[model samples]
Target: MMRLRFLRPPGARPEKEFLARCLQCGQCAQVCIFDCIKMRTGFNPFTSGTPEISPRDAPCHLCMRCSAICPSDALEDVSIEESKMGYAKLDRKLCHTWKGFIICRSCYERCPLKATAMVLEKGIYPAITDRCVGCGVCEHVCPEQAIVTIPTRFVT
Candidate 1:
């Protein structure tokens, strides 16, 4: 079966290690101030109840509170720069600014790591940089739906 593409909380360990270490305790979900973290719902015993973030529905703010409260150490306590959530892929063809339809900074302006993660190319088009931690704010805020956040777990 194809697994759903979803991001783990910030500072999450690798997929395998994260699953093994996750206690399904729901603490991470409970502490999320943005309410972006949701426990996977289903009968799959192994993955059910695990915290997952659906960026388009609600992007993580990278507050790091969930990691701080996790008793199992599944999500490490790391700085915003070290979160490694994933990376945002921008489809310029669909971006208003990139296409020269209008000047839009929705993604660039909303990015938590503004100048580092997302940049304005030629003072117009939005560009994703390697420093992006893929918190998904870009994806969530893009009016043109031009940004997609590829979770780190699915990178390989």
Candidate 2:
């Protein structure tokens, strides 16, 4: 079955491997300061209670508290720079700046990584860079809904 483009907590391992390793404990959700992490609900035995993030509801703050409390190695205690949660992709067709109409800097302004992850190409259109950890802040903050955060598991 095809899984949705679900964003996992930062430092999560590969999707398949993570589902196998994660104990479905709510530890990560309990430790999150921003309350961005939520235990998966419903009756999915493979991943029920596993921590996930829905940027649309609330974006991750890169606090790393969840990883510190995770008992399973599914979430690694890694630096925010290496968290590799996901990557932001810009949809030029929907981007106001890319359309050459608005001077919107919403995505760039909200990106936690700032200049390193999201930057204005030619001092105008916002472009997603390799440094992006895909925290989904850009996706969450984009006024035009032009930015999408792709989970690391799908990046490869």
Candidate 3:
């Protein structure tokens, strides 16, 4: 079975440190302008009520509000480039542009970091760059569902 993957709010520390510092106060959820942050809902005491972002439902806009309002410093105040929420991986096999079926720039046009995070290789195929902070905008805008955001916590 595939493990359920979800992103933490921007500027989230490493999983262990984030859990230790998190107050589970829901302040991050309350302050999210995009309503991207949701308190984890489950009976598991270890993870219940922790802030999580489901990028497909709603992607982080990188406004930095949630991190700024986190009183426990569980979510650090960091710039958009430093957020490190996750990184986007594009599947060339499923991508419309890469497959040569159509020129789809949806992911590239919607990416907050545009040109920097998701670039148009050969001015056509969308390519993820090393600068990607994994804000999930690319995954959210992908019409072909060719993009996936691998959460930073899981990557480490």
Candidate 4:
């Protein structure tokens, strides 16, 4: 099977486990404060109603409320610091700041984990760090489309 890449809500298990464990109850979507979580669409029986976050539409705030109310533990109640929904990768060649065409700070300014997940190199150009949780805010805010948030969905 061709592995599909998509960001799950924080606390989601590996792909196989998440599909098996998720009840598709929509509880996680109900409790999301940032309204980032949305039920998966399409007719795939293996993935219907599973909560996902598309940072371009809305970015997760790292609030663990969705996990806390999960009756089936499909979304584990994990610490915000440990959340790894996805990671942001910068294409510096396409970046306005890096290219010196513009001093755009869109990604840096919008990063939820600013200074930790996204930082300025040499106090100017933005760089992604280890602390990045791949929340996709940078991807949403990048004016030059220089950022692509890489989802961390693990497949078996």
Candidate 5:
């Protein structure tokens, strides 16, 4: 499986404070310019109104649409820098590189952060760098599902 790196906001206080206040009414989701805001299934058993988005499915663009539309401050106001999801990891075992396939570069080629995040290594099959942003675009774009982004907290 591809390694994922989760980047919680600095000083994140269960930052669920914002999350807990949400009504999950879909207003914020509707206002998302990038469609990154989504409600999680069974995110809360007692309270079903909380909305959560998977940064892996669609990383927040920091457009602030969701935060602005949130009536209850369920989505806190954060700067793009404060809200980054962080680096992504590519599993050599599941990647086409390890499989000896030549069908995909979607991960390497599609990375929005470029050289800083997905640098290339020299080899017959090649490899990705350590600076990945865990955007999951590589995982989603991969036809093999060889890539997965895990929370950075789990690493090290």
Candidate 6:
């Protein structure tokens, strides 16, 4: 998958270049405060060691846990914003609740971008809409590891 770079302000360096040096060992993923980062199998193998952020799947709250522990430059100094960061996408098929199993919607409850970001459907298994902000709360708290914050360009 091609690495995606958002528009940076003046004098800002390419985030991909920083991510290029990442080892993708998942060390940063473990230390992240908001659980915004995730590992991907396919994509830029060149920077495979780094974790990626998606606002809908896992939004970066700027807690800086991942960047704090990054051994490489993968998560170098960079500012995070709701609009700039692509959010998480949910796979209902992989979700425990969608599978007719009892599961908590912590992500839905913890979302900072409620209403517009996450809309709940009334059904036996409620569906979360694409409006989700991709906060890592669900992925972070999930015991099943069903959700992940995939790269925006690489998700398909």
Model 2 alpha-carbon drift over 4 Å, by segment: 1-3, 154-156
Off by over 4 Å in 4: 1-5
Better of 2 and 3 by lDDT: 3
Model 3 poorest ten-residue lDDT run: 1-10
Each model's C-alpha lDDT?
A: 0.91, 0.85, 0.90, 0.84, 0.54, 0.51
lDDT of each residue in 48-114, candidate 5, tens digit only: 5444445556654446666666666655576533443445556777777667767467776776655
- Each prediction's TM-score versus the true structure: 0.96, 0.92, 0.96, 0.91, 0.61, 0.45
Q: How many residue pairs collide in each prediction?
A: 0, 0, 0, 2, 12, 20
Question: The CA-based lDDT of model 3 is what?
Answer: 0.90
Off by over 4 Å in 3: 1-3, 154-156
lDDT of 4 at 115: 93
In the range 15-122, model 6's lDDT, one tens digit per residue, is 555444656688766776655556654655665545565443545655655655666644454443333234455677777777767756766666556555665666
lDDT of 4 by residue, 1-156 (tens): 322556888877777888889999999999898888988887888887888888777878778899899999977888876778878899999999999978999889878789988889999989999899888888888888888878877733
Clashes of 3: 0
- Expressed as tens digits, the lDDT of each residue in 1-156 for candidate 1 is 324878999999988889999999999999999999999888998999999999989999999999999999999999999899999999989998889879989888888899988888788878999999989999999998999999997443
Q: Candidate 5: where is the Cα deviation over 4 Å?
A: 1-15, 21-25, 34-36, 42-47, 54-64, 68-82, 123-131, 151-156
TM-score, cand. 3 vs. native: 0.96
Which one is best on lDDT?
1
Model 3 residue 107 distance off true place after TM-score fit, in angstroms: 0.4
Candidates arranged by lDDT, highest first: 1, 3, 2, 4, 5, 6
Q: Which is superior by TM-score, 1 or 6?
A: 1
Instruction: Indicate whether candidate 1 or candidate 5 has the larger TM-score.
Output: 1
Clashes of 4: 2
lDDT of 2: 0.85
